[model samples]
Target: MRTVAYYKGCLASLSAKELDISTQALAPKVGLELIELEAVTCCGAGDIHEAEPDYYLHLNARILAYAEETGADTLMTVCNVCTLNLRQANHALQGDPALLERVNRNLTKVGVPAYSGGVEVMHFLWLVAAGEGYELLKGAAHRGLKGLKIAPFYGCQILRPSKLLGFEDPDRPSSLERIIEACGGEAIDYPAKIKCCGFPIIQAREETALAELIQPIEQAKEAGADAMVTPCPLCHLSLDAWQSKLKAQTGKDFQLPILHLSQLVGVAAGLADSELKFKRHVVSVAPVTDKLAV
Candidate 1:
């Protein structure tokens, strides 16, 4: 089995617990043995990076250090922001020797190992869309999605600032669509698939956030997507949880079911809905499940 250090960011550990559950459950089925970084703290969700850049590097470097301790060359994350933060840190530390030494000195004081910038930061979606993981996904899909129409949502953090997270073409990403097709689902093409879900600015601008959140769902609905799937828990929160608020503000009900990437893969792999934690979602996934049944 391919071994990697799994890092579930703050949102996945808390509000998006189902994302964590489904990811862990789906890993072994795809020939992956996840060594979860249990002691790792949050990647600061970009807030720390913007306000306190040095502390943000330390936090993410600490996470990388923990991953190094696991003896895994790869550190896999389910959240886009976490992936970005960790990658940004990795890039910074690897390129600047003096900065690495300084961070190492601070880490040493806390009894944590100094990170050598050896671990490669990767997103789970990238794992499944290419290489052996893609083959494993194809093999595990016993009961494929047959006729389900899934819109691929590549949230901002996972794709943008391509110099750092350059796994796929940020402008025209096809990883989600590739996975959907692999599982026998119809991949719907829509403009809002690559747009921001507005989670980052939700607290600062509720109205703007809701507007950003609704656009993709509305576009997906217009494009005939039965459901939407995303790799980022923050994006999932904006698309799924804040949907009600969007309805409240607009007086329009766009009941688009949002699935975590892992959950969608689990469904295609014939995993029981309960195992995927379908009940935990704010929006009912009944529409998607019902269609899958038919």
Candidate 2:
């Protein structure tokens, strides 16, 4: 089993507990032994980055320092925002020796280990799509997705600003589709697959967020997607939990189930629905689960 430092981020650790639970359960099945980072703080989720750039760097640098303490060469994240923040911090620190030295000095003052720019930050989806994790997934998916048509939702963070999180082509990504196929499901290709789910701007612009959220599901539903899967819990929350508001706004009921990338893999690996916490979702995953072969 490949051991790496796991960073579940704020959402997975809190509001999106199911993502954390499912990811922890699924990791071992696919030959990954996750050494979760201890006492890690929020990655600022882009808010701090915009308001206080130095503070954002320190926060992410602290998280990376925790990963370094774990003695793992890689730091794994499940959230798109967290992945971006950490990767951006890593890039900035590694590219500038002076900045890394200053950050290390700050960490030292706090009795934390100085970061040596050793850990490579990676998103879980990228791990599965690009390495031996893919082969392990294929081997472990005994039950398989069979007839399910899963649409891949690669929300903005994981794909955009390609210089930092450039695991795949931001313009034309195929990692999610590759993962869906590895689990024996048909990967539905849709234009909105690469579009934003609008969770970030929801608080300030409800109308705009709803408009952005509706397009992708509408396109996915039209394309005959049984369910849509995303690596980001924030996207899952906006796409799944906000459906009621969306129905209220547009008068169209979109019951399309949104599964976290981990849940999708857990199902394909023959994990029980309860184990994956399907009941927690606002949209019934039954529509997708019912199509699976027993």
Candidate 3:
């Protein structure tokens, strides 16, 4: 089995435990031995934008530092916020020695050694696609997710700064879309496919954020998508966790099912319903799955 360090990003471990558990479960199923890094902190998602920006950079760099210390070439993450923060930090550390030095100083003060940007950051979806290879998953599928109108939400973080992705396309990503198709799910090309989920300004610019995210969600809904599928947990939190708030803000009745890429893979692989943890989501997948089943 291939070994990889699992970085559960702050939101995944705390705010979104369901996705975290699903990620951990999916690993062994796909022939991966997941070693989780201890004392893992937030990937500087919203916190990076607040109080001290430099500290956020160091904190994020520190996580990458920990992953490198384990000698793991690839670090798997589930949160879009965490993936974005870690990848951006890795790029900064690799390009600028001075910046890496300053962040290292912060890391040393905290007893967490500095990182030199060697470890690669990958979302769990990418790990399944590349680490185990798409062929492995396709061979393991017990039942296809037939007739499911799966909306592929790439958001922005995973597909930017092409150098960071190594081989994956940074802008027009097919990583998640391809996975859906491999498992016999219909990957729909909705208009807001690559739009940002307005996650950056959730607290201060909530109204604007809601408008940004809601537009894409509304588009998916109008497009007749059965559910919104994504690899990022914060996109899950913002789009799924805050759906009620989004509904109140928009003053209309709307609900769209959001499933992490891992959960959808579980569905195609014939993993049990409880293992996928549809109940953990703030937005219910019961209606969506029931409809899909019929």
Q: List the RMSD of every prediction in angstroms.
A: 1.0, 1.0, 2.5
lDDT tens per residue, model 2, 166-212: 88889999999988998989999889898999999999998999999
Q: What TM-score would candidate 2 get against the native?
A: 0.98
Q: How many residue pairs collide in each prediction? A: 0, 0, 1
- Per-residue lDDT of candidate 3, residues 171-269 (tens digit): 567788888888788888876877889887888998888888887788888888888898887788888977898778767656788988888887778
Which runs in model 1 stand beyond 4 Å of their true positions? none
Candidate 3 clashing pairs, residues 3+ apart or interchain:
159-170
Off by over 4 Å in 2: none
What is the alpha-carbon lDDT of model 2 when measured against the actual structure?
0.91
Question: TM-score of every model?
Answer: 0.98, 0.98, 0.89
Q: What is candidate 2's CA lDDT for residue 233?
A: 93
For model 1, the local distance difference test gives 0.91
Question: What's the C-alpha lDDT at position 256 in model 1?
Answer: 89
- TM match of model 1 to true structure: 0.98
